[model samples]
Target: MAKHCTIIQGGMGVGVSNWKLAQTVSKAGQLGVVSGTALDQILARRLQDGDQGGHMRRALEAFPFPVMAERILKTYFVSGGKPAGTPYKTIPLLAKDNPRELAELCIASNFAEVFLAREGHCNAVGINYLEKIQAALLPCIYGAMLAGVEYILMGAGIPLKIPGVLDLFAEHRRAEYGMHVVGALEGDNTTMHFNPADFTECKLGSLTRPKFLAIVSSNTLATTMVKKASGRVDGLIIEMRTAGGHNAPPRGKLQLTDAGEPIYGERDDIDIAKLRELGIPFWLAGGYGHPEKLREALSLGATGVQVGTAFEFASESGLREDYKRDLLQKVISGTAHVFTDPLASPTGFPFKVAQLEGTYSEPELYAARPRICNLGFLREAYRTSEGDIGYRCPAEPTTVYASKGGNAEDVVGRKCICNGLLANVGFPQVLNGQRVELGIVTAGDDLVSIAQFLPPGQSYYSALDVIAALEKGCSVLST
Candidate 1:
């Protein structure tokens, strides 16, 4: 017999669903997930920031590969911290043929995040990744597996090949993921490969193949994943239009409401009964932050619920204090509004945004920031005229994005989500006149629902509070 839960703390990326938050939930006997997206860069930045609270140092010490840990520490660790106003050094952008250092960083960084989250907890922990961020997949998965991560939850794109990659690493073999290069002809080489032998000096350690859960929005994609995936997909997470982070685009031609939000109609509704016919475990997301919702999911035959907005504002989460405070106040007042912005993300998926002042979601704030593309995480790789590959992001400068085939109109109100997201977790970069560029914050449509997690008269709630609220009624499903 094995343990399962009726609630999963959804993986919020760019350090929002951090180790401490995840650990808190997992310790309370529910599935806790650490966001594995952009962790390599986040880890490097943390090291440069003097390894705050010595937590990174502890995780690095626990890393199985001592030499790899040593190499990363020697390269990125600053004794005190980088001076104020001096930007953290950016690592080279990940390409099909990555530099060895970048590859190592990906592995070590992913390992550290999961390792820290699982520390002192025998309960299972999970890692989440967006399939669109393909560059770091192999090493990132490898590192999480190395850290004994119990589950891997992925969404934002159909990940047809990830299960095979997990199997390869579990067997201590090399894993190769095909990169989706824009404008590449049928015969063009676009596969990225990672061999543990190349990086590990000794024989590779045996790794466990974690449970694979594909996040999906509809029954059609769920069926496709079950029937067409390269390997075993353990489960599915059914995220509705209301979930936080990126969302699946509406089917057919995109239509907008008078308020500018993407219109989700009858076709967008998921057929849960059809989902059950697939014979796989599934969790319901989006507005599923309440205990009543958990019961509804169970009654409907779901294994559990995956929640984001509530846990996101918990005290232990990595969201910055000012933003969290403002948002929490709104939640308490039942006035927080989340709009499904269709143009904010480079991936072109409908991104959920909290309407906060001074954030990139605000028109004035967005207009004030100059267009730049330093992060490049969201840059798309395309085959150049000479058969070389080039990367570009629609959120970059208008002239540059246009030259790369992006339509100026399509990018009109688009904000650079990469930098903004990084800023959300307190690493906002300072530009001219000490103006900190703000990243738009994304949360589930149940923004006001977070208030339920807080006790009456309590101004703040802990991750435990969220878990308790979610687990109140069903004892058997609590763990």
Candidate 2:
């Protein structure tokens, strides 16, 4: 039997949970997960920044396909990084019918990250992906598998087909994911296909199928996944509304609080009793970062808990030093606050925004920024009048979004999450060589409590510090 991991480090924003953080947590004997979101773009930007520390180049040298690895290095790696104020070159946005170059980038980039994270440790590592980003899903999974990823966790949608894709990919066979296209007629083709053989230079043995853990918010979703998922669902992470990043919208009619946040009622709560009846290992998320909460989870039949906010500010995470410094200061002063903004995400899901000045969370800063959708990670696919799939984002220019059949109201209050998240990790794109993108910070409600991990007289904490604290919590209660 596989040993249970008592704690799973949360895979956070953009590059925030990059290889370094994940590797640190995994080295501490817990399951560490790297954020699989926008990894291709992150890898490209890292190379363009001169592959600092020679880490990207090191990982690429170990990639199975030398030709593919060489192509990526040649295309993106700069001699000493791009000049300050110069815009980072953009990769093509993903689509149902993606070009070969984009697919190769996804595969190679994912491979490099997982490869690097798995280095210097024999412990298992995981990768987290948002199911909504379907276009790049196949190649990304294939790349991670090439680096021997042990777990694949997904949330943000009904991921019924992901398990089956894992099965096919393990045998090095072709895999396809059905793209969800809005306003599609009965016969529209919305399937994305990828084959490992097409991208490989030589024959290879079959790979192991990584265990799949679907992140769910309700008993209904969990039950549906266990009973109807195309293949075996190894486990689940039950995330509450208080968790960081994109939250599952509240159940039933959308009601807002007086403060403009979504009102999550009793119905929004997941029934732990029902989840226990499913006979699978499950973890509790959201506000379970404390020792008492970890103890409570174990007593309630949970396999473990996944923590985000605490690890997010850890010294090894990819979060920018200035932002981390400011947030930690707020945590110390009790001035830290998180707002669950209902209209900020283009996905229309509620996103938690940590109150930080000079970020997009500020009303004045948000309004001053121009609406551009060049990154296009969050664009929704819709059937055009020509019966072809066209992409649109509410965060795009108002007139441009409207011309693509998007509602004017939908565009209201929508912020460009793609750009904001990238900027949070210090890779913001420079538009027209002058307008630099600003970042928006996201953290769970537990952001205020992360001070417990800080050493006496120290402003920052490490992943080992977090693991020791949570493990001590579990140990104290177990004794």
Candidate 3:
């Protein structure tokens, strides 16, 4: 079960793979994921910023569903910390009929971040997500399988019903999920249910399915996720186009490179022997984070390597330590750059971008911030010429996304990336004069090879020192 570890840390999302960088890469055995995306609005803004070192009250006192962690700590804690310029309150919009305390704070904030990154680790602990955030996939996979999460992953899209929603929480039932919606029509009502007995109040302990993977980038999306997944995917993370946050774009029409970014030639080459004839287990994300690119992705066959700009500049990543000390001093002075940007992600994919100055990839700091969509997690539920189902955001306010049908030139320069990736992890959104904004950080293009996961002079390193220098070899493939 130790899956030949080379490293799989790459789950950097809104809170940049928190829970102390997935418990220091699952206590060094390697695979530590945990970025269940907007983890219930980053666990309700870390319990309205008061649950500080109590660490979401110690992962909601190890939630095994204790009344959904006492009803999400009696509705998002907030006992002390909300004053400093006042903002953490917004938890409402997640429709398709959500409520019941936002589905128990999306299953106790994805079961307290996969129960504190599988606490004191027994090793295996994965949880990523972002199949275009389909209405928080069944209370975030029933809160990361009620904290036992042993690998789910998922990509930016084409997550063909997430292995039947992990076989309906390993059979404790009620899963539903279909909501992509955009135009709606053939009898409408786009699905979206979830009933592990309507949020488990008692007899429910079943969940053990996990193992899904699917973060593909080609070889035809890894042979269409092993011939159209709906139940058992269990592999593939391919990811290239120099991976970091979101990337897979360039195949035909879109070209860019004069530093605008995208342009991936050789027809975006990815055939690795047709992905080794699609026989399950795979891994190998862009610029494959170190150690001779994890032995050149295990001599071209690969079942290892998923790093994210070297565990997103490690020191237990949830980023923002002055943006990891100014991007690790521009990656130890080689001057960090990163840009895959294709209009910086409103799920328009192609998004690496990190030439940071005041952030938002600096076009004068993204034209001095302003466009404000108040964190509607990549909104796009469409269909409202009166037929209802609203939610817009192509980074919002191009006249409220052209009054909801969107397409004012498809939202120019997009960038809301959920409140700038929760203001690149120091939880931004403060508005109305006290300022704040500044986020734009995304990673890969080997961001100056993360100074080879720093150590020579030790600038800072952790996710178990970048998975122990990529399991003891190092130079991640000369960028």
Comparing 1 and 3 on TM-score, the stronger one:
1
Q: Compared with the true structure, what per-residue lDDT tens digits does model 2 show for residues 1-479?
A: 56769999988969999999999999989999999999999999999999889999999999999999999989999989999899999789989988888999999889988999999989999999999999989999999999999999999899999999999999999999999999998988988889898999988898989999999999999999999999999999999998999998988999998999999899888899999999999999999998889999999999999999889999999999999999999989999999999999999999999999989999889999888899998999999999999999999999999999999999999999899999999999998789899999999999999999998998889989999889977898777
Clashing pairs in 3: 290-476, 291-474, 291-476, 462-465
lDDT by residue (tens digit), candidate 1, 108-195: 8888889888988799999999888889889889889889999999998889999999999997798898999988998899999998
Report the C-alpha lDDT of model 3 over 317-383, residue by residue, as the tens digit. Answer: 8888888888889777878888778887877878888887877788777667778787677788877
Instruction: Give the residue spans of candidate 3 off by over 4 A.
Output: 1-35, 43-68, 75-85, 89-107, 111-142, 147-151, 155-204, 218-245, 248-256, 260-263, 279-362, 366-419, 423-428, 431-433, 438-479
> CA lDDT of 133 in candidate 2?
92
Candidate order by lDDT, decreasing, is 2, 1, 3
The TM-score that candidate 3 achieves is 0.33
| Lowest summed lDDT window (length 10), candidate 1 | 470-479
Better of 1 and 2 by TM-score: 2
lDDT of 3 at 438: 73
Residue ranges of candidate 2 with Cα displaced over 4 Å:
none
